[model samples]
Target chain A: MASPLPQLQPEVAEKFRSTVIPCRIEMPRLGLTFDLRTLTLAEALELMKIPDFTYLVPRPKRRKAASSSTSK
Target chain B: MNTFSLTHLKGPQGDDNTPGLLGYVLVAREDAFSKIAKAPKTGTTAGETAIITDNHTFTNADDGFAKVYLTLDSNMLKAAITGERDGRGLKISFEGFHPGNNAEALEFMRIVKNLGLIILVPDADGTYLQVGAEGLPVEFAPDYDSGKLSSGRRGFTVKGEAYANGMYIYAGTVKYKA
Candidate 1:
């Protein structure tokens, strides 16, 4: 990317690395979701420490399309 | 579902200013992970072993994150979680830029666009989340822009796959192996 910084009007202090990177993850396993900036290897490991933090992807529901459409 | 209230804050717990993203993003092959790291629906101590990375153990010190350089202190980085848009999986996206377009970087970015991946995104507040961690894989949309002209801007925009769901990553122990 162009190294020349965008001509942005300085808003926050230079010391503050304020980058609006929003991330919200849902833990259906625990019926919970939270907002964050990002997830890292270390952070993933940190979540493991929360006891039973299982992140499993359930198979997609193969609903019968024709039947469902008819019902609708 | 309507349990909490979004009342206006006016007391001591009103000062809410959080930092944005910082540091590097972590990406790995999807197959490298498995049905491990079983945390309970409710518990204090972790029952069994957590997710293992290529059979290697991760420690707390250097941690398991691959710290890389970021542009604008990772300001350009973004991880948008929009839940599952399609029946297949969670449709999501992530995009950012790396400073250089060297040969090594070029080749790596080229190949990674096809790799099934789960990316770990970190935040400046010390929290994190994993994209495509919910039983699906993500690929990258690498776009290389060369600012050849005086007004042109050079950049390599890496937009991760908008498939699979991301999970709330808590503070836990991680072990990554090459």
Candidate 2:
């Protein structure tokens, strides 16, 4: 049987696996797409400050307690 | 080894007298030449002009050319060199100048807002580089010294990116007898 994937040297495979993947972001509203490199720690942190998806979380709602104390 | 000097700079479609390093930096809108055609051939006849097919042209705003710098964004080429992609990115900077009239500033601002393609020609002798996509004018400051000196020099900074489908850089060489 033949392998489906091409055989790569160990070092070559390691180099390949270690490379950072680029990021592509699309903004349909603006009709724009950006091809960007992986973000550095600093850049990621800066992005964290923005209220994007990473920062958005649904807040839990509080329910009123029932007035059951009258039965006691 | 071969060497060359930075003698003068020119604007897109500008005539020979279009001011160079000492005078003004020009930003004109252009189409993505890469999608339209291959890179222009280097070393053509002295008087011949390279005709670009399906080219898009726009008005330009001229600013004083204090200094200009260009560099290859090699990181963008990693995938392309490995035959995984087709293009890379180039970074260019246009710095220093007296803020021209409001119209010129507005024109440049419009280019930034619209993300228009531009060509940054760094030599008067027909050597130039085209930047595809929007040339982002990241930083701009006017009247740096508050017009303190009689010369009245203002400063501005613009950073540009080239699309992968277009040529990233076009380098040309000129020889002179020392």
Best by lDDT: 1
Interface RMSD of each: 10.5, 20.9
- Residue range A23-72, candidate 2, lDDT tens digits: 33322222333322333334334433544322112234455675786567
Each candidate's fnat: 0.00, 0.00
Ten residues in sequence with the least summed lDDT for candidate 1 chain A: A6-15
Runs in model 1 deviating more than 4 A are A1-72, B1-19, B34-68, B73-90, B164-166, B175-178
On the 0 to 100 scale, the lDDT of residue A22 in model 1 is 22
Docking class of 2: incorrect
Model 2: per-residue Cα lDDT over B61-156, one tens digit each: 111112222222111111122223454343334444445335655565544545454443434433343334343322222222334466653333
Tens-digit lDDT string for candidate 1 (B1-178): 1213233446647554466665567665665554323222433334212222212122221223233344655333344556445633345666677767888778878878777776666666545555664356667787888877677556677777655332445334333321
* Per-candidate local distance difference test: 0.48, 0.32
